[model samples]
Target: MNRLMEFIATGFYSGKLPKMPGTWGSILAAILLYFLWPTNLKFQLLIIFITFILSVISADYVAKELGNKDPDCVVIDEILGMEIALLGLSADIKTVFLGLILFRVIDIMKPPPIGFFEKLPGGLGITVDDAVAGVITNVILRLIGGLL
Candidate 1:
Protein backbone atom coordinates (compact mmCIF):
# COMPACT_ATOMS: atom_id res chain seq x y z
CA MET A 1 0.00 0.00 0.00
CA ASN A 2 0.98 3.60 -0.52
CA ARG A 3 0.66 4.38 3.14
CA LEU A 4 3.07 1.63 4.10
CA MET A 5 5.55 2.64 1.44
CA GLU A 6 5.23 6.29 2.43
CA PHE A 7 5.89 5.42 6.04
CA ILE A 8 9.02 3.48 5.14
CA ALA A 9 10.19 6.06 2.64
CA THR A 10 9.73 8.83 5.15
CA GLY A 11 11.85 6.99 7.66
CA PHE A 12 8.83 6.43 9.86
CA TYR A 13 7.79 10.05 9.31
CA SER A 14 11.04 11.58 10.59
CA GLY A 15 11.32 12.98 7.09
CA LYS A 16 8.09 14.89 7.63
CA LEU A 17 9.62 16.82 10.51
CA PRO A 18 10.22 20.50 9.98
CA LYS A 19 13.39 21.34 8.10
CA MET A 20 16.23 18.93 7.37
CA PRO A 21 14.15 15.81 7.23
CA GLY A 22 17.15 13.96 5.97
CA THR A 23 19.04 14.97 9.06
CA TRP A 24 16.17 13.83 11.21
CA GLY A 25 16.16 10.49 9.51
CA SER A 26 19.88 10.19 10.00
CA ILE A 27 19.51 11.12 13.64
CA LEU A 28 16.91 8.44 14.12
CA ALA A 29 19.17 6.02 12.32
CA ALA A 30 22.13 6.90 14.52
CA ILE A 31 20.06 6.34 17.61
CA LEU A 32 18.91 3.01 16.28
CA LEU A 33 22.44 2.10 15.34
CA TYR A 34 23.71 2.96 18.78
CA PHE A 35 21.16 0.80 20.50
CA LEU A 36 20.71 -2.03 18.06
CA TRP A 37 23.88 -2.34 16.06
CA PRO A 38 24.97 -5.91 15.65
CA THR A 39 28.48 -7.01 16.63
CA ASN A 40 28.98 -9.29 13.67
CA LEU A 41 30.11 -7.75 10.41
CA LYS A 42 28.08 -10.27 8.41
CA PHE A 43 24.94 -9.37 10.30
CA GLN A 44 25.65 -5.70 9.77
CA LEU A 45 26.10 -6.22 6.05
CA LEU A 46 22.89 -8.23 5.88
CA ILE A 47 20.97 -5.51 7.62
CA ILE A 48 22.36 -2.91 5.24
CA PHE A 49 21.44 -5.04 2.25
CA ILE A 50 17.90 -5.48 3.48
CA THR A 51 17.53 -1.81 4.30
CA PHE A 52 18.93 -0.89 0.91
CA ILE A 53 16.30 -2.98 -0.84
CA LEU A 54 13.50 -1.58 1.25
CA SER A 55 14.76 1.95 0.81
CA VAL A 56 14.92 1.63 -2.96
CA ILE A 57 11.42 0.23 -3.25
CA SER A 58 9.77 2.56 -0.81
CA ALA A 59 11.62 5.63 -2.02
CA ASP A 60 10.67 4.93 -5.61
CA TYR A 61 7.03 4.55 -4.71
CA VAL A 62 6.99 7.76 -2.71
CA ALA A 63 8.78 9.69 -5.44
CA LYS A 64 6.27 8.56 -8.02
CA GLU A 65 3.38 9.45 -5.74
CA LEU A 66 4.81 12.90 -4.99
CA GLY A 67 5.89 13.56 -8.55
CA ASN A 68 9.19 14.97 -7.40
CA LYS A 69 12.75 13.84 -7.58
CA ASP A 70 14.19 13.18 -4.13
CA PRO A 71 11.39 14.90 -2.30
CA ASP A 72 12.06 16.01 1.25
CA CYS A 73 9.49 13.58 2.58
CA VAL A 74 11.56 10.61 1.55
CA VAL A 75 14.53 9.85 3.78
CA ILE A 76 14.93 6.12 3.87
CA ASP A 77 18.02 6.94 1.89
CA GLU A 78 19.36 8.78 4.91
CA ILE A 79 18.68 5.76 7.08
CA LEU A 80 20.47 3.53 4.64
CA GLY A 81 23.33 5.96 4.32
CA MET A 82 23.69 6.32 8.05
CA GLU A 83 23.87 2.57 8.40
CA ILE A 84 26.57 2.45 5.79
CA ALA A 85 28.50 5.24 7.47
CA LEU A 86 28.53 3.48 10.78
CA LEU A 87 29.05 0.04 9.31
CA GLY A 88 31.77 -1.99 11.03
CA LEU A 89 32.40 0.76 13.56
CA SER A 90 32.11 0.13 17.26
CA ALA A 91 28.67 1.35 18.28
CA ASP A 92 29.65 3.85 20.88
CA ILE A 93 28.05 7.25 21.40
CA LYS A 94 31.09 9.16 20.16
CA THR A 95 31.57 7.10 17.02
CA VAL A 96 27.89 7.02 16.22
CA PHE A 97 27.51 10.76 16.65
CA LEU A 98 30.63 11.43 14.62
CA GLY A 99 29.41 9.11 11.89
CA LEU A 100 26.09 10.92 11.87
CA ILE A 101 27.76 14.31 11.41
CA LEU A 102 30.11 13.04 8.74
CA PHE A 103 27.31 11.33 6.84
CA ARG A 104 25.07 14.38 6.94
CA VAL A 105 27.88 16.60 5.73
CA ILE A 106 28.93 14.33 2.92
CA ASP A 107 25.31 13.77 1.93
CA ILE A 108 24.50 17.45 1.99
CA MET A 109 27.65 18.49 0.15
CA LYS A 110 27.14 15.79 -2.51
CA PRO A 111 30.80 15.78 -3.35
CA PRO A 112 32.05 14.41 -6.68
CA PRO A 113 30.36 11.16 -7.70
CA ILE A 114 27.85 11.52 -4.92
CA GLY A 115 26.21 14.29 -6.91
CA PHE A 116 26.48 12.24 -10.05
CA PHE A 117 24.66 9.29 -8.47
CA GLU A 118 21.86 11.61 -7.43
CA LYS A 119 21.12 12.23 -11.10
CA LEU A 120 19.94 8.65 -11.56
CA PRO A 121 16.25 7.96 -12.07
CA GLY A 122 13.78 6.59 -9.49
CA GLY A 123 14.70 5.15 -6.10
CA LEU A 124 18.20 4.26 -7.24
CA GLY A 125 18.86 7.94 -7.59
CA ILE A 126 17.24 8.67 -4.28
CA THR A 127 19.38 6.17 -2.39
CA VAL A 128 22.68 5.78 -4.24
CA ASP A 129 24.02 9.19 -3.34
CA ASP A 130 23.48 8.61 0.34
CA ALA A 131 25.08 5.18 0.00
CA VAL A 132 28.04 6.86 -1.64
CA ALA A 133 28.17 9.45 1.11
CA GLY A 134 28.12 6.65 3.66
CA VAL A 135 31.01 4.93 1.93
CA ILE A 136 32.98 8.13 1.92
CA THR A 137 32.15 8.82 5.54
CA ASN A 138 33.03 5.27 6.57
CA VAL A 139 36.37 5.50 4.87
CA ILE A 140 37.07 8.86 6.45
CA LEU A 141 36.12 7.56 9.87
CA ARG A 142 38.31 4.52 9.44
CA LEU A 143 41.24 6.69 8.44
CA ILE A 144 40.64 9.00 11.34
CA GLY A 145 40.27 6.13 13.76
CA GLY A 146 43.43 4.65 12.37
CA LEU A 147 45.27 7.85 13.13
CA LEU A 148 44.27 7.82 16.74
Candidate 2:
Protein backbone atom coordinates (compact mmCIF):
# COMPACT_ATOMS: atom_id res chain seq x y z
CA MET A 1 0.00 0.00 0.00
CA ASN A 2 2.82 2.38 0.93
CA ARG A 3 4.65 1.45 -2.23
CA LEU A 4 1.54 2.09 -4.29
CA MET A 5 1.08 5.45 -2.62
CA GLU A 6 4.68 6.31 -3.33
CA PHE A 7 4.28 5.30 -6.96
CA ILE A 8 1.21 7.49 -7.34
CA ALA A 9 2.59 10.44 -5.40
CA THR A 10 5.77 10.43 -7.42
CA GLY A 11 3.96 10.49 -10.75
CA PHE A 12 5.30 7.05 -11.53
CA TYR A 13 8.77 8.11 -10.32
CA SER A 14 8.93 11.14 -12.55
CA GLY A 15 9.10 12.97 -9.22
CA LYS A 16 12.24 11.06 -8.32
CA LEU A 17 14.10 13.10 -10.89
CA PRO A 18 16.50 15.63 -9.39
CA LYS A 19 14.63 18.79 -10.38
CA MET A 20 11.21 20.13 -11.29
CA PRO A 21 9.21 17.12 -10.29
CA GLY A 22 5.96 19.01 -10.77
CA THR A 23 6.84 19.68 -14.38
CA TRP A 24 7.53 16.03 -14.89
CA GLY A 25 4.23 15.19 -13.33
CA SER A 26 2.49 17.62 -15.62
CA ILE A 27 4.18 16.03 -18.59
CA LEU A 28 2.95 12.67 -17.47
CA ALA A 29 -0.51 14.11 -17.13
CA ALA A 30 -0.34 15.42 -20.66
CA ILE A 31 0.58 12.00 -21.93
CA LEU A 32 -2.28 10.51 -20.01
CA LEU A 33 -4.66 13.16 -21.33
CA TYR A 34 -3.53 12.26 -24.81
CA PHE A 35 -4.40 8.62 -24.47
CA LEU A 36 -7.14 8.12 -21.88
CA TRP A 37 -9.08 11.31 -22.51
CA PRO A 38 -12.83 10.85 -22.22
CA THR A 39 -15.42 11.36 -24.93
CA ASN A 40 -17.43 13.96 -23.02
CA LEU A 41 -17.33 16.57 -20.28
CA LYS A 42 -19.28 14.41 -17.79
CA PHE A 43 -16.78 11.57 -17.99
CA GLN A 44 -13.91 14.02 -17.83
CA LEU A 45 -15.27 15.55 -14.65
CA LEU A 46 -15.73 12.11 -13.13
CA ILE A 47 -12.14 11.20 -13.94
CA ILE A 48 -10.82 14.42 -12.45
CA PHE A 49 -12.89 13.96 -9.30
CA ILE A 50 -11.62 10.46 -8.79
CA THR A 51 -8.08 11.56 -9.42
CA PHE A 52 -8.63 14.39 -6.98
CA ILE A 53 -9.70 12.03 -4.21
CA LEU A 54 -6.86 9.60 -4.84
CA SER A 55 -4.30 12.34 -5.23
CA VAL A 56 -5.27 13.91 -1.93
CA ILE A 57 -4.97 10.61 -0.15
CA SER A 58 -1.66 9.69 -1.73
CA ALA A 59 -0.22 13.17 -1.44
CA ASP A 60 -1.08 13.45 2.26
CA TYR A 61 0.49 10.11 3.08
CA VAL A 62 3.56 10.79 0.98
CA ALA A 63 4.02 14.25 2.43
CA LYS A 64 3.80 12.89 5.94
CA GLU A 65 6.26 10.14 5.17
CA LEU A 66 8.64 12.63 3.66
CA GLY A 67 8.20 14.97 6.64
CA ASN A 68 7.36 17.94 4.51
CA LYS A 69 4.48 20.24 3.83
CA ASP A 70 3.89 19.77 0.11
CA PRO A 71 7.01 17.89 -0.66
CA ASP A 72 8.31 18.44 -4.19
CA CYS A 73 8.31 14.72 -4.87
CA VAL A 74 4.60 14.31 -4.25
CA VAL A 75 3.28 15.64 -7.56
CA ILE A 76 -0.21 14.16 -7.57
CA ASP A 77 -1.17 17.81 -7.33
CA GLU A 78 0.31 18.48 -10.74
CA ILE A 79 -1.62 15.64 -12.33
CA LEU A 80 -4.88 16.93 -10.93
CA GLY A 81 -4.02 20.44 -12.04
CA MET A 82 -3.28 19.41 -15.60
CA GLU A 83 -6.40 17.30 -15.80
CA ILE A 84 -8.50 20.25 -14.73
CA ALA A 85 -6.72 22.62 -17.04
CA LEU A 86 -7.34 20.54 -20.11
CA LEU A 87 -10.89 19.66 -19.26
CA GLY A 88 -13.22 20.00 -22.27
CA LEU A 89 -10.33 21.05 -24.44
CA SER A 90 -9.56 18.99 -27.50
CA ALA A 91 -6.68 16.53 -27.46
CA ASP A 92 -4.90 18.12 -30.37
CA ILE A 93 -1.28 19.13 -29.98
CA LYS A 94 -2.09 22.81 -29.97
CA THR A 95 -4.68 22.50 -27.24
CA VAL A 96 -2.49 20.27 -25.13
CA PHE A 97 0.50 22.58 -25.47
CA LEU A 98 -1.51 25.67 -24.66
CA GLY A 99 -3.16 23.98 -21.69
CA LEU A 100 0.19 22.80 -20.40
CA ILE A 101 1.73 26.23 -20.66
CA LEU A 102 -1.27 27.93 -19.15
CA PHE A 103 -1.51 25.52 -16.26
CA ARG A 104 2.20 25.68 -15.45
CA VAL A 105 2.24 29.44 -15.57
CA ILE A 106 -0.84 29.90 -13.40
CA ASP A 107 0.45 27.28 -11.00
CA ILE A 108 3.79 29.01 -10.76
CA MET A 109 2.26 32.47 -10.44
CA LYS A 110 -0.24 31.34 -7.77
CA PRO A 111 -2.22 34.56 -8.00
CA PRO A 112 -5.11 35.51 -5.67
CA PRO A 113 -7.67 32.75 -5.19
CA ILE A 114 -5.17 30.26 -6.46
CA GLY A 115 -2.60 31.35 -3.91
CA PHE A 116 -5.19 31.19 -1.17
CA PHE A 117 -5.68 27.45 -1.54
CA GLU A 118 -2.04 26.86 -0.66
CA LYS A 119 -2.71 27.66 2.99
CA LEU A 120 -5.03 24.71 3.54
CA PRO A 121 -3.79 21.77 5.59
CA GLY A 122 -2.08 18.59 4.39
CA GLY A 123 -2.75 17.40 0.85
CA LEU A 124 -5.49 19.94 0.35
CA GLY A 125 -2.83 22.60 0.59
CA ILE A 126 -0.61 20.61 -1.69
CA THR A 127 -3.30 20.07 -4.31
CA VAL A 128 -5.96 22.80 -4.23
CA ASP A 129 -3.63 25.58 -5.28
CA ASP A 130 -2.74 23.67 -8.41
CA ALA A 131 -6.38 22.85 -9.10
CA VAL A 132 -7.21 26.51 -8.80
CA ALA A 133 -4.48 27.25 -11.25
CA GLY A 134 -6.05 24.74 -13.60
CA VAL A 135 -9.43 26.42 -13.16
CA ILE A 136 -7.87 29.72 -14.05
CA THR A 137 -6.37 28.11 -17.10
CA ASN A 138 -9.77 26.72 -18.02
CA VAL A 139 -11.25 30.20 -17.78
CA ILE A 140 -8.51 31.57 -19.97
CA LEU A 141 -9.08 28.84 -22.52
CA ARG A 142 -12.78 29.55 -22.47
CA LEU A 143 -12.09 33.17 -23.19
CA ILE A 144 -9.80 32.21 -26.02
CA GLY A 145 -12.35 29.78 -27.36
CA GLY A 146 -15.00 32.45 -27.24
CA LEU A 147 -12.78 34.91 -29.04
CA LEU A 148 -12.09 32.43 -31.79
TM-score of each: 0.98, 0.95
Point out where model 1 deviates above 4 Å.
none
Q: What RMSD does each model have against the real structure? A: 0.8, 1.2
Tens-place lDDT per residue, model 2, 43-102, is 999989998998888999998998898889988889999989888888777777888888
| Candidate topping lDDT | 1
Give lDDT: candidate 2, residue 119. 92
What's the lDDT for residue 83 in model 1? Answer: 91
| Poorest stretch of ten by lDDT in candidate 2 | 89-98
- Per-model CA lDDT versus the true structure: 0.93, 0.87
lDDT of 1 by residue, 1-148 (tens): 4789999999999999999899999999999999999989999999999999999999999888888887998999999999999889898998999999999998988899898999889999999999999999999999999999
RMSD of 1: 0.8
Give candidate 1's error at residue 111 in angstroms.
Answer: 0.7
